[model samples]
Target: MKKIIFILSFLFGFTSLYSQKLSSNNSKAIKNFNEAIKLYENYNYLDAINKFKKAINIDPLFIEAYILTAQVYSDLNMFDSSIVYYKKTVEIDQDFFPNAYMFIAKFSYMTGKYEEAVKYQELYYNHYKLNPTQRARAKIDLNIYYDALELYKNPVPFKPINLGPNINSIYSEYSPALTIDDSTIIFTRKVPVKDKAMEQEDFYQSKKLPNGNWELAMPLLGELNTPNNEGAHTISADGKILYFTACNRSDGQGSCDIYRSYKIGNTWTKAENVKELNSVSWDSQPTLSADGKTIYFASARNGNMDIYVAHMQKNAKWSHPQPLPDNINTARSELTPFIHPDGKTLFFASDGHGGMGGYDIFYTKKINDTLWTTPQNIGYPINTHKDDAFLFVNASGKYAFFASEIENGYGAYDIYMFEFPKNIITTPVTYFKGIVVDIDDNKPIIHAIAELFSLKDASIAGKAITDIDGSFLLPLPAGEIYALNISAKNYLFYSEHIELIEAYDSLDPFVKYIYLRPIKKDQIMVLNNILFDFDQATLKPESYVELEKLYNFLVDNPNLVIEIGGHTDSIGTKDYNLILSEKRAKAVYDYLISRNINPQRLRYKGYGDTMPIADNSTEEGRKLNRRTEIKILYNN
Candidate 1:
């Protein structure tokens, strides 16, 4: 309405300057034009349009009448008709209203006439003398038209498959979030309230069957789904924690604010407002990283909606939210930011970055802590004339899920799945899924911390905590070797090296059953992540991460005495293997002592091939046999 008022006032200002010349010579045409203006002011747009057309019929060259009719059609969202009348005014006198060319270009683009839009936009830019701000905006529009034309000519492969009736209905369903494994999907469903004109939004979830079909979706259980609106959510990689948007509740700080909930067993806990993220203005559409340590969401605290980010603090509270750089957010609304499991690529929706029309989906890469790459439109068709948002890419980077109101859909906005072009994804990702258990009774070990470290820089890649069932998932980014360390209180830590340097697929993930032995006398555990050069005892630099973990374990258990044991495979002579193993054991013993583990409490031993855990006939068995082990000699 504001835009319409502005357009009407601007047109009136221009026409008033040439009222004598632009007006029709026929008094009947002038009378109809005045009556049309009165009808438009009364909000009778259809009647006003008819009156403007009557004025145009009375005097075929009445430029003001033609302009008014086009404006009315535009307000009615009849862009094709709007373009026709605007073009008629142009045919009469193109110089009468220079801004008319701009409108025609915009309407053409909105109606998907890309080439025509580009032509009129170029004429508008070349003929008009615009101020700096106006010129910049016009340039942006021109670029958008060109880009839309290019993409329209070369479309990406996009076939959106609906999630089906089990997860969708006659009601609108959108804002879909998926677990890392793609085993579950949670989305917002807009359902009509009983006997009311208003609709209510609630969270719904569906689990995938072994046959790869989704089970019937049901409203999330527990106090999480209240009568108040709940929508636009994100689930943790493991699907145990949920961060979502809720509005008009007693606990809200704004009309709409972000809320968080936890799933325990089969029920979700009551949602609590994320006060740190909420403001007096609207804040919503939260997305969590794979590690659940960072969040990206949209907020209108500074007026127009922009993407904001906050990191989870050590105290478990979120840090103060900060908006993304201007390169990503503009003077217009930006919403529904989804950070991929890779922790770098971010997909969002923005109107500020000009594209086809309305909001278009864009993606950017996080270059560093303070910088991000410029956002790029994902392309046409995937991003149409209508608003396109809420893109959720699965961990594999192979497919994405979004909502659309398309032909044959079961709902107004049904969740749809589409594959991503491999070229568009900057980095692929996979998850490390496994269970941790006690070695003695084989019982699940809850609250064990699983941390992944990039072997290149030894920086932390991702982390996860074992659930009640001892299940955990850690995101492993592509193109790196990672060392995984799992530790729990009162238990020996476990370590293993995961190689993902080659192309990795999410469908084939790294799965393991970790057995954590209780710290006790004579308990021996292999330090699987410890590395050395062939036939050399000197520790490689890659061994430091695991070595640090081992050092921490010894420091935490100061009263225990341990022996470092090194074993050899059956490929070498017993005499040579014994000497080599002894030297390797001594090397670990010396390193631990140098790190302040009391030498008096440490011992070194060579097991050679005498204590092979696996048959040393194959390479896998031989690799398992040649290992470094830590055995508790005495526990006080």
Candidate 2:
């Protein structure tokens, strides 16, 4: 009844004259009222409104005509005139149109007259009997309006800036997705297809200008687009892969199926259905993890539309989809799940959970693989009593982007970003980017995984794989030191220690190049991270991280024997340097032996001031010269 009342209140308020004769006996007034009803039924609202006013002028007591006039005005979006007619009818005779209470309440509620709406709503329910569904909805809306009051009282401090004319157009733009660095935004734009009556949605992208404003959006020039619609997409943190929604396609498994495309250099490959994740129902609105190993999306496969997640298997396949926990997915619809690059925080929209009403934006933190904390609303103002979903945030967590059909927009809907206060920002992150190539031919190495581990605790921090171009980016929590190990089949593992504690921002990407050497003899590489006490032979505790990498390499190649060579800068007497370098080399050999490596397979040697790879005249060069290196001696 609440929904019907809510909608009807906006339509025409009417009297309970179902079995009675016309109350107004004026023949001309009755004729005009009948003509007005026919015009209203045919959706000629302006003509119906004029006829209704004519009937009222002839018979001022025509309450039904007054109700019809209000309905026409409301249909025209003239809420003030609509409310005036509704109130005039009430003043003449409240009982003549008891349903007018509900109509007045609806107009009041829409115009920020919450208290008046509530007052009139109570009068409506008390006067009429409600069915079970109506009562339940009424109760829910009542509580929602009360909550909305509180939300309006205390709003979150946000500054939303329009993306400007370059990005918006006379057509609708919505469902904005951004790269980890916020350099590009892809959105869906509805445009008329020249001669066709039906509008089409296409994927459009806007590049961020040097001044930071987005440039004019253009349809994707690659084969990712077709005559059919393509929308609701999320870009991988590295901006290499796009996951999106396409409906009613021949290859689709349901009404809407999730599709993906890979970025080859600057062009996107053809779209392919994510067959593993799609079902015979709706499966759309996908979000890819920062590491590109997990997919989160909304699906109705489980009967109720809920958020489901799947993992990227070791063979580069998707795992079986599993619905999120009850905390995140309720019996009602839950959609638009955006897992932030940090991987712990999740933002989505839900109508099932208790909210201000309709679908409201919410956020939660993943407690573990199968559990998440109860969602908290992104807050009022940002989320109104209408449907609001599809929110994306940058790696820095400073701003959030979403679509809105707000006033003064360029068209139907425009994308906007809100600067979030510190309270709502998630954990800060810094992206580590690099390219992987084969040293033999300088060709790109695709699908190589870069595993990041925390040196402080040896915990796995994050992972990212090289794209077709051998370029990779990993978003790690800022202010930490990590040990990054790159792995690929039939290639020797590469290890490096990175310290990003001083990089307090996520905007500037840190780049490093990795040259993967093939598994061959005579391959010599430096372990510049191996450290020791000042001029002493004892290894520092932090040096164990690099030693562990050596240990693993040895364990992975059991039959191989390596000579651990230590080099010293020309800082002391040659004789003294040789003795110290030999002890440092022995320290590494001893650690490997302790890790169960055969003592006979390892050899320790010192080349003091004899094999300096860099100039020992400068402090930086001297630091690089005092290092540990490994040489492939034999593999049988």
Candidate 3:
């Protein structure tokens, strides 16, 4: 025995004396590993990873160190590193096989390596029984992977069809918005009104029935309607809130401001203006996102109407309104926006991008969090040479509803529904027809000016002159209130505020009848009421009231004017009657002058006995001819 130099180069340097030193080093390594564990527990994963790496370097064979280091890498989302270390642990000790395999499976799933994840998951499952929580989590991940695989393999076929009369009506009804579950629907309907006094448009709504046929349409109740005009409503996904436009009054912030209302049970509460988003310019046509976290609307505040958006903050307040990205809003008008249920596609009507003629339906798809692609025109058959706006699509991404003019329509415009194919849809249209007559006589009032004012934009939108039969036709946007004014030369200004909340589903045209009183001499009419005075060569203060009526009449007629002549009773000399009548005629001229009536708009002449209709011999007859008369001098 060569002195048996048992130079024990202990495999891990564990000579009895060296064992103490090795234990000390192990303790140091253990201390470092424990510090890293503490960091890992607090979720300081990056720092913990550094500490774990240092500990493993000091003790290359520290099995526990390798296992925890792999876990720390996994916590930091370094799945590849976690897999490498986990594999090393299993290689060093077969006993750690199952746990290593399970971690590798989890990491693979985290990295989207679904096939590898499934293979390792099977191995883990074969050796270990997972608790309920682990099983549930694993199942969820599996389902996600399966769905993603399916999505990648084949995209779902999107076939859009036009919702026929089952949901739409002849009167303009469109801009359909619905709740997330598709249980409720809120849409705009431009229907005719019964006894509508103003020239403004009309709109109404209908609900879905159990059998899927929409129930008879009804106008929205409560204070949401006005005689002015209101429509283009947007309902939140829950169907609990509505936003619309109301215009033509002193309370408006501008031409129109956005308004909101909340549904309480079957009725809606009073609507309040969305002042935060309104400006001195026009604002209308609001559309809310499916999540109710964003609002899109049209505004003319920047001189031309364009689309803008305001985000809903977590605190329930709206953020400052900002113009929509360049892809959506342009210099031209962009209105009637509809955000689809998927919250990834935006549909809107735009005149900026060239289309069929007027505003055409277009769509844009969201590419990423802050990016959207250029819009695509919903081409040909769906659009036409006229204005085609206010679109609504159902939950299945099929079936659309909109407003259009059809042959033999009941009124100027009507709502229609057709099979709008995902690829191509024929233009569908309808109309609402009715007549306007004297409310008292039931006879049609001719040449009466009918005006429709939008309550949302607070401005006059459309006007029509009654036909020879006192009948007029008007097109309406759905879900709005309108103020109708029907004024004739001698009739009291006929006015009626129409609320279209109930107009939808009411299969009849909005029948309107107006009564006009005659204006003649000795009618106790105001003379300044007639724009004249006794012996004065100037117009009096009260003259404007009557002259304004005349001015408005002229304005409405556009091509009508007359000569105003004056006469007197023969209670004086022939020279006196002629001279007196002439003075009276000039007096009438002076009166019109003060009222800003154009001199060229009138002619004046006096005929003493020349134009008398009654005998100057009797006081009654003389009084009748001692009058002022306006004869139509020009008519176009």
Candidate 1 residue spans exceeding 4 A from truth:
1-9, 12-21, 128-137, 555-559, 570-573, 615-618
lDDT of 2 by residue, 266-299 (tens): 7889999999999999999999888777889999
Q: If ranked by TM-score, best first, what sequence of candidates would result?
A: 1, 2, 3
Can you write out model 1's per-residue Cα lDDT over 1-636, one digit (the tens) per residue? 444456566975543332345458899998898788888878899999999989999999999899989988998999999999999988998888867889999999887889999999998887755667877878888998998888788888899999899999999999899888888899999998899889899999999999999999999998899877888899998898999988778888999989999987778999888898899989998999987788999999998899999998889899999999999989988998999998889999998888878889999999987799999889878988788889999988899999888999996889999998777675677888999999889999999999988889887777888989998988777889989999999898988878887877688888889999998988888888788889888988888888889898888888889889999999889988988899988888888888988888889999888899998989999998989999988988
Best by TM-score: 1
Give per-model TM-scores.
0.93, 0.75, 0.39
Q: After superposition, how far is residue 541 of candidate 2 from its true place, in Å?
A: 13
- Model 1 residue pairs with clashes: none
Error of 3 at 18 (Å): 99
Better of 2 and 3 by TM-score: 2
Q: C-alpha displacement of 475 in model 1, angstroms?
A: 2.0
Cα error of candidate 1 at position 286, Å: 1.7
Q: If candidate 1 were superposed on the true structure by all CA atoms, what would the RMSD be?
A: 2.7
* Better by lDDT, candidate 3 or 2: 2
Per-residue lDDT over 527-603 for candidate 3, one digit per residue giving the tens place of the 0 to 100 score? 21332344444544433434445566555555545676767666767776777677776776666677677788777
Residue 162 CA displacement from its true place in model 2, Å: 3.9
